[model samples]
Target: MVTERLPAKISEKSEEKKIAPASPIGIFDSGVGGLTVLAEIMRQLPNEDVIYIADSARVPYGGRPPEEIIKINQELIPYLIDQGVKLIIMACGTSSSIAYPVLKDKYKVHIIGLIEPGVRAALSATRSGTIGVIATAGTIHSQAYQKTLQSMKKTGLPAGREIKIAAEACPLFVPLIEGGFIETEETRKVAKEYLKPLLKEEIDTLILGCTHYPHLVKVLNALTGGKVVLVDPAEEAVAEAKGLLQKAGTMKGKTFPPRYEYLVTGSVAQFQDVGSRLLGKLITHARQARLPTPERSDGGQVHLPLK
Candidate 1:
């Protein structure tokens, strides 16, 4: 169930307020793709409130310049923090690859990106020490997953066995998924061409590197014929979040129904329609939100409005 309401005014002296256990977990993405992550979070951490921000106005961050991605995140991250979220999840592969490393340490709230979790999961699932990753061009260009896998391969797998990694950039997947073309023959055709190289490499494990790629699981599975293990990084990322919250003693109590707030920087009607279809539940309402202007104050902080 979803409902629309005005956001409460957040105090300017936000730093003074402690992020309590009951504070909402914030998740943001380039667009509706992040709903994949949100689904895992809901299944695993049902009692916690969630504030999801979809930067659909700038959807498809895949091919953007690195500087532009960072700038866009500079606006979105602080806006989420201002909403009083206790933690933030970088649910977009492009952002996770390009912006996360640059911005993670600068923020006060804990930020979890999809790369590390994905690399770890792929390593765990690869019995043959051969893995393939498919994501957006920006993510592939950044070489985030490839580098991480290379670095961790020695320790993650048996000593003598080497890890073979094949990475591909499937830029069309996002547009197809966002356009609500999940199971179409065109999607299957595109996916088949994309997976051909990885299949030729005989990879035993495949990482659905983009959050948007999970929606194409049916096509993916059919293409692989149940021979390859598929890893959805959202599962590991949410599990890591659960572990961190538990260790920090900040898991929300099961005393009440969890609140789910949806905000977008684009069309509410479109987001609701596609999001509902992807999530298999009606997104009855989603409030439209704007990012704080890029101008920074003397202390180098983005000035967010109280409302």
Candidate 2:
């Protein structure tokens, strides 16, 4: 699961001291939902440049087939690579669950996903040895959380104790959050319904599996009575990335603050609007970029046209 921060094939000249290793870290999400992850990375790694691409044109990957999401990422990733990103963050839960392994093995650059960090944090936060995961339908269907917890339990849990993992798919949460209904009472009602199962389980820790789920933290927290701890993967993921980059000697934070660049497949205005809401501040220039289309003639390969 470990990936190099940069490709060895990258010109040694590019690795020289004349250029800092602080190139942009690329992040991709199915849609505006990923801005939450992007914001976390910005807050945690202020010295590193960031590039976020929102695939709003095909927003919800949650219900898409794994192969389809893989196809989407195969096209999306190389564009980011060409942007000179030092690392790639699969901010979308669907992509992380299904596509990350293939991309991580194929790409020489470091690739991090959102799911594992959340799972790890949930495991750590749970004193009752029971963890609840709430995610998009696709993520839940993928059984990523279930599989992860099972593997960890087999290897890491004490011989007598079992780690119980409960997962629910809150499909409505994504649309509600992305549609700017985060603060509505409707959202509260929906959150209560969706979270009641976990509340009954009395699980001590909950993982906000979808990047969009964090947007409803207030509603979710109220439903849990502030007792159950909520784990935001974005936070954990950035922390992991910080440690990884530092250990790799690839971070440059002793000088100026890191710059950030944002790219989106949808209109710049739309991304800016949602991004600002997610970041809780103004989002500066975000250049518009189109996602590549698949060319069947090329064996389901993505063909990028001139930007």
Candidate 3:
């Protein structure tokens, strides 16, 4: 419940006025991985406009230090707020695990992370007491999923039934997925090796801990022989967002087609190329975003370019 204060400019803008339901919902990740979350949002809340940011320039947040990850989010959140988004989703597993706790109540806007929803779904899907989580190294190292499962299982599962959690960090997943190697045999072989340990534990439920892992559903489903239930946090997160919007009366009306804007800190063409395939749709509106540089030597505030 700790809240970190935002910069004066951002705080004033975000808190000074009521956010409209028609404003876009913001979603972001280090790279194309967040498209999985975007896909779910589009499917479940088709009436809400979406603005998605891909910080591909700083791709693979999994390996970054906690301080660096927090700093990166500080930049990304303000930028999204500047765009007048009503809510924000931290769609990256590394960010959800490492940065979300630090920044959760800090911003005026409602920020939803992927961890809790995925954990809830995994807990519900497990027929046995065994569950597996596969995510990036940073997420696994954070112990976010494992801890949540343990804490929730105490009340959520049958009494006296021991819960076993197995976690594996698949570091190579983001690169392979971002490179558009979803259904290749090479990717399949790598996935099998990565999943071997969890399968050894005989886990009946597997959480797709990283957003990018959802893109490899076919490979993972094939490897697990359709026995292990794969939980995609994106679906649950979107469902949660939809419920919150409805309860708050902030759900957008069905007056027009929802607008979709794509922004990336890296190459626009590359993101469009890989992202289009992953989302199973053509991306005709992607553009590069020039984020503000880190704090200046004199401690002056940096400003983003006007949209």
Candidate 4:
């Protein structure tokens, strides 16, 4: 058996001390998409304080360059850490695929992303070795899903079952959903078109690679004819997050209302409105903020207003 060695820095943290039990959990997505994950986290860990950031100004990271996605994550994670969060969740699929590897090494606190958990869930649910992944273009192009599944197969488990992956980049799905088209005929049509190939490949499990993608769960479930197990990363990821909080002694022992904070580099009112509708919470406030200007040389910061 081969054992993977932890980096010296990570070992130092565990050896030195665990995160403060009461510290808030920080979570960020390119935009409102992460609220899906946030909703799940809240459901499972209601008493834990949470600070969520929606980088709505830079919404829809599906087709962005890898460097741009990582740069944005670089800004978001550090800001969350500066707010004294004990843990961070990369709630965007594109960021999970492209940015997590680069940013995880730079941070001291535990950073969790959607990919590995999504991969594990897909693996566990699949009776046949074929898996279907539907995510953003950036995520699919990064090949994160395929790589993780194949790596697991190499671990010599499941003896004769070989994992095969079929990934599709559904670039327009996010826009469709964010535009309030979920459960609409337009959404159904687009989703069916996006899912056709995977169904054709006889996938027994479909991984909803994007956090935003889960908002279309009913649409996807119906389209897949209820024959396929829909593996949602948020569900699996939050389960692991619960264990981590417990290990760090951060799991709330008694039920108490915990503070929930929201921030965004976009329209505050808009984020609050849409956030409230999607998250099942009255999001009364969202602070307008800025990421360091993307073009450092020019200092031309992009401030996008959420629609």
Tell me the whole-model lDDT of each prediction, alpha carbons only: 0.86, 0.75, 0.85, 0.79
Better of 1 and 4 by TM-score: 1
**Tens-digit lDDT track of model 3 for 1-307:** 1222223344424443457889889999988899999999889998999999888767788877777788778878887887888899999999999999999988888999999999889888888989999999999999999998888886677788878999999999898888888899889999999999999999999999999999999899999999999999999999989988988889999988899988777678889899999999999788767655433222332333222
For model 1, the stretches where C-alpha displacement exceeds 4 angstroms are 1-16, 291-307
- In candidate 1, list every pair of residues with a backbone clash: none
Q: Could you give candidate 1's per-residue lDDT for residues 33-119 as a string of tens digits? A: 999999999899989999998877666888877887887777677767877888999999999999999999987789999999999
- Which 10 consecutive residues of model 3 have the lowest summed lDDT? 296-305
Measured on C-alpha atoms, candidate 4 has an lDDT of 0.79
lDDT of 1 at 64: 75
* Stretches > 4 Å off in candidate 2: 1-20, 154-159, 293-307
**Model 3: residues with Cα > 4 Å off, grouped in runs:** 1-17, 294-307
Best of the candidates, lDDT: 1
Estimate the Cα RMSD of every predicted model relative to the unseen true structure: 5.6, 6.4, 6.2, 7.9
How far out, in Å, is residue 276 in model 3? 0.8
Candidate 3: the clashing residue pairs are none
TM-score list, all predictions? 0.90, 0.86, 0.90, 0.87
User: What TM-score does prediction 4 earn?
Assistant: 0.87
> What's model 2's overall lDDT?
0.75
